[model samples]
Target: MRNLLMKVNYDGTCYDGFQTQPKGNTIQDRLEQAILHLTGETTKITASGRTDAGVHAYGQPFNFTTSSQIPLERWCLALNARLPQDIVVTEAREVPLSFHSRRGAKRKTYRYTINGNRFPDPFQRRWQHHHPVQLDIPAMQQGLTHLIGTHDFTSFASRRSTKTSHVRTIFEAHMEIDRSMCRPSSTDQGVIYTYVTGSGFLQHMVRIIMGTLIHVGEGKLQADEVAEILAACDRAAAGPTAMSQGLALMSVEYEESWE
Candidate 1:
């Protein structure tokens, strides 16, 4: 058998999540069903990470072992034919059998978008979180600076998460306004986007970080107080966890073992 890695992009607005479930549609179920249809064999695929409901992904990676002789290009075409319209396999290639997508990943980048305007756009409502209040960008940036290093992110994670350790390294974290990316609406205010790239993220870590920064932006939390929250390691000290629809897993990086 040969192992193949596939890069998938999906709009998570319609599905439950990435993982397969017995009741609802999922990215994993659809991909596996498509593979079974094409190759006539049930293939168990593993993904780089699990995205929550309503969260999208651009370069999510997954690997499956298959004995079929179909070309790599056919994996996309054949799967796209059977898969739902919301999910698509963008690329596929042969990989080492031992190369597990999640275990081999070195880093991941996620972006959270906020519509910082008085009026929300109907078209972009499903993709962005609308925040009517004017945010103080400098204060938000100050809070982001404190998040640039390694720390125990217990305050930024969900209480239900089963992870043993909350300590994770954040290589970079920043927020920026993308004027050009904002959809035309009643208000011309630019949209604020938080881009976070880290070694790995705890459950709901990015959403909680966005919530804390939003509080800082609204002047509810002091920028300098972020360090205190990190030191406290109390989940209740952080702001509310933001919605999942505004978050997207942009990419996952791995070493060039195949190259």
Candidate 2:
């Protein structure tokens, strides 16, 4: 058997999530079904990690072993033809059999978007969280700076996570405001973009961090208290988990060159 790696992007609005579950209607289930149709082989595609329902992905990598003779270059087109309109196989390549998608990933980047408009924009509702109150961007940025180092992120992780260790290193964390998306009548807050690159994340970790930073923006929590929350190593110390629709898997990095 040969291994094939593929990079895919999906809207993720309708599916349950990335993994195949008993309930079905998931991104993995659809991809597996398409592959079974195209190659007549039942293969499991291992993604870098699973994103929650309603979370989109811009650059998700997965790999599967196949005995089929399909050319590597044609895999993307072939799979796209079989996949749903929302999920597209962006690229595919033949990889070493030893390569594993999830285990090989070195870092993952996630982006959380917020629509700061008082009235939610109809067009952006599916991909952004709507927040009517004006947020203090400077305070949020200050809070984000504290998250840029290796630390135990238990405060920001979901209690449902089964991972044994809560320690994770965050390489970069920042927020950007997209002024072009703001309405004239609304506060200059516009749209808020939170980007985080980390070694790995626990379930709902990014969302939880976003919620905490949002509290800082609202003056409910001080920027300096983020470090205290980290040291507390307690979930109750963190803010609520933000809505899932605003979160997206931005990209995955690997030490091994796929080229």
Candidate 3:
């Protein structure tokens, strides 16, 4: 059997999440169904990580073992033809049998967009989180300083997570404004956009961080409080978890050693 790695992009608005679930449709379920239709193989595919409902992805990676002789380019086109419009296989290539998508990943980056304005735009409603309150960018940046580097992110994770370890290394975390892309009439004219990159993230980690920073932007929480939350190691100490729609899995990185 030959192993193939595929890069997939999907709008997470309609589906449940990335992982397959018994009660609802998922990105994995649809992709696997398409694969079965094309190759008649019931083999399961492995993804780099699981993204929650309403959380989109740009370059999510997955691998599956298949005996079919279809060429790499056909895999992308054929899968896109059978899959729903929201999900698409952007690229596909053969890989060594030992190249596991999840195990081989070096780092993953996630981006969260917030529409900080009084009114929401019709077009960006599905992809961006809308908040009416004006945020203080400088204060938000001050809070971000506390999130950079390594720390126990237990306080930022959801209470429902089954992860044994709460400690994760964050390579970078900061907020900035995307003025060029903001709509002319958007309340987000001077709104700030938050971008974060890290080796990996805990469940609800990015959202919680965003929520906490929002508090800072609103002047409800002191910028230094972020450090206190991390030191507390309590979920309740962090800010409320932000909406999942604003979060996107930007990309997953695999080390050269894996190649």
Best candidate per TM-score, number? 2
List of clashing residue pairs for candidate 2 = none
lDDT for position 222 in model 3: 95
Report the Cα RMSD per candidate: 2.0, 1.1, 1.9
lDDT (tens digit, per residue) of candidate 1 on 1-259: 9999999999999889999878978889889899999999998899999988899999799998989999887788889999888898998999878889999988899999998877777888887999978889899999989988889999999999899999999998888786874456546557888899998999899999998998999999999888898889999999999999999999899987432
Inter-residue clash pairs, candidate 1:
none
Candidate 3 lDDT, tens digit per residue, 1-259?
9999999999999989999998989999999999999999997999999999999999899999999999887899999999999998998989899899998887888989887766776887888898877787888899999988889899999999898998888887777676765557756554456778887888899999999998998999999999999999999998999999999998888985433
Tell me each candidate's TM-score. 0.94, 0.97, 0.95
Candidate 2 per-residue C-alpha lDDT over 1-259 given as tens digits, one digit per residue, 9 for 90 to 100? 9998898999988989899888768999999999999999988899999999989999799999999999888888999999989999998888899999999999999999998876788887889999879898899999999989999999999999899999999999888888886667756478899999999999999999999998999999999999999889999998999999999999999998763
Off by over 4 Å in 3: 181-188, 257-259
> Total clashing residue pairs per candidate?
0, 0, 0
Each prediction's Cα lDDT score? 0.89, 0.91, 0.88
Worst 10 residues of 3 by lDDT: 182-191
When 1 and 2 are scored with lDDT, the better candidate is 2
Best by lDDT: 2
TM-score of the candidate numbered 2?
A: 0.97
